[model samples]
Target: MSNLHARDYQPDRQGTLDGIRVLDLSRLFAGNVLTQLLGDFGAEVIKIEPPEGDTLRGWKTEGIETHWKIYARNKKSLCLSLRDPRAIEIIRKLVPSAQILVESFRPGVLEKMGLSPDALLALNPSLVVVRISGWGQDGPYAQRPGFGTVIEGVSGFAAINGFADREPVLPPMYLADGVAGLYGASAAMIALREAEMKGRGQVIDLSLLDPLFAILGPQAANYRLTGKVKPRTGSRSTNSAPRNVYRCSDGHYVSLSGSIQKMTERLFRAIGRAELIDDPRFRTNSDRLRHAEELDAIIGAFIGERTQQENVAFFEEAEVTIGPIYDTPQIMADPHVIAREVIADYPDPEMGHIPMHHVVPRFAQTPGSIRTPAPALGQHNRELLAEIGISPAAYDELKLAGVICGG
Candidate 1:
């Protein structure tokens, strides 16, 4: 349904970051997600990996072939072993031409590689350096290795995310890392915009913990102001009763929320329980909340007899707040999501037409694109080296010396 032609979809031409070049030296979820965000907005992102490649190359549960094919999309890849002098020399040659450098190693890894922010800035003072880390570049745990799961646990997000009666559990995905990457990318953009105005670049030290800690939001505020640590209350509205998921006939689930008296009455009327509106315990929201357990029993008894479609139709016609508990398959099959074009088909040389989620905050003019497939290890090593004016003989020599690899 998109009217734009592939030829006319010049990525950089649309986004404000039209001519920005990013040297991405990060890997795994956090760093990769950030680079993907920038790439989506028209920046030219060159992802650098070690010869063995990013560890995420094996992320897919199915197999390496599938994992590597999809995770590295929309960018060029260059595999270089930074420990080698030739590799360092090659990176140095790249610095002068780059507008930004995004790296996600432990605190001192870049300095050890002789490509610290200070050194890179010395070569190109206009370069913005974004360093992503679990604990940031300094502090007691700065050098410690961590992943999304660790941050989730430490940040107390896992503590308030499960059923009240059950032990706390981590969310089943890498939400912490993914969100951190998004925030990091946002910070990078702001810094870049400021640099363009001042004609001077700045460094962004983005800590995964910062975003993780900030996610607590109101809950943190509650604890700070009231000394109360919020506990998990699955599907239950904090302020009202009868605002939770309920089972319907045909083994389907439906969510209901009627916090206001009018909405509650509408819900009751929809279920043919208008008489309950006058009942003493159900007269007010406070009264209903006080006897929530009894109210849930009554609501459940009425809802359990109806099929999912029947309940959904009744609620829709009445305009009461209710919705289906959609699983992934259900979401994919939904006509609304389909009409919105919320999914993208990413093509790869190894795997044809891989489906991926669409980027959010769509641009009106220079919309970002997944134009190219994921790189295969060092697929762009020669091209990149050529851009840096490295002769073909030198490229071959570096490859032969194990400083770089060619896919």
Candidate 2:
């Protein structure tokens, strides 16, 4: 690798996770995202992978696995075969120094490898073991392998998404997995806090299905009250009026959200229809709901008359909530995106500029930064092994015997 990729950003400012160490025994998307979240905040994350590297590293964009480049930033890599006992021994040695361990293997894999929660805690009494699985660690569906798409379908996300006319949509994104990773990261923090206070650590049994379901925002409550599954309404929200995507004159689309009375008034005023605010059919939220289609048509027509940029400017001036349905390039070029510093580019010789999203939820005092680039397989083998007290000779022996993948 080049010097720029090898170099990591060391912020002069303090970070919230500066003293933390994490052992990431996960691959693909969800678990990897979780560790990256921690690492973004200055956690020393060591990713343990099998010899061949993470399965998702093969996934490509423009002939590059861009996902790995962004999500695995600020973390080190250690390639080791979990099938080997010495690998487990190496992990046990790491456990004592690590504050958190994240894993996404199927329910019984850890137990099979003799690295169950009990065994891990025995090695490090205060370790926060975060376990994320498809249906959780103990349920009937726990043993079966599943990914974000499968979980979305089973967890009712797909059921509530997309148009009623078409087959339920599996989101283009990894919806469930991303939600699960956030939930898992938050759970790990809570567990770490409690462990520090109580002088003991515990296992976090987080399910891929549950977190996505939990974030449905009153969908379950609505179901319980009505005893009916909410019908899908495409891009429109079932709970609100005049909430949908509308095409502009320029053939671009923009999303509008005039859900509340205040926002609806602003929208109406901007569209030169202030008189509609006092009309009986659009006075209140309930009244507007009854005439949602009519209101949507009015708004959509107004939007259709204008170019996307014109509508964007009008919404900005009117202070109504609106946004362009931007593609990747559009978003990257957006003014607000640039102003917020949403994307940061790093030095990459081949790619020229490696653009990735910056760390989120800005902190006034302890903000996170994009420090390191993604690691090559086993890039941190020697340095990480040294921290765990493995000698140079032992490392050579392990590599020679195929006990470790990278040394």
Best by TM-score: 2
Misplaced by over 4 Å in model 2 are 1-8, 11-14
Q: Write the per-residue lDDT of candidate 1 for residues 47-165, one digit (tens) a residue.
A: 88888788778676555455455445557898998888888888899988888899888889999889888899889888889998888889898988867788888888888888899
The C-alpha TM-scores of every prediction are: 0.90, 0.94
- The lDDT of each candidate is 0.79, 0.86
Which residues of candidate 1, in runs, are more than 4 Å off?
A: 1-16, 64-71, 239-241, 259-262, 275-290, 349-351
lDDT of 2 by residue, 372-396 (tens): 7888889999998998788999989
TM-score of 1: 0.90
Instruction: Tell how far residue 217 is off in model 1, in angstroms.
Output: 2.2
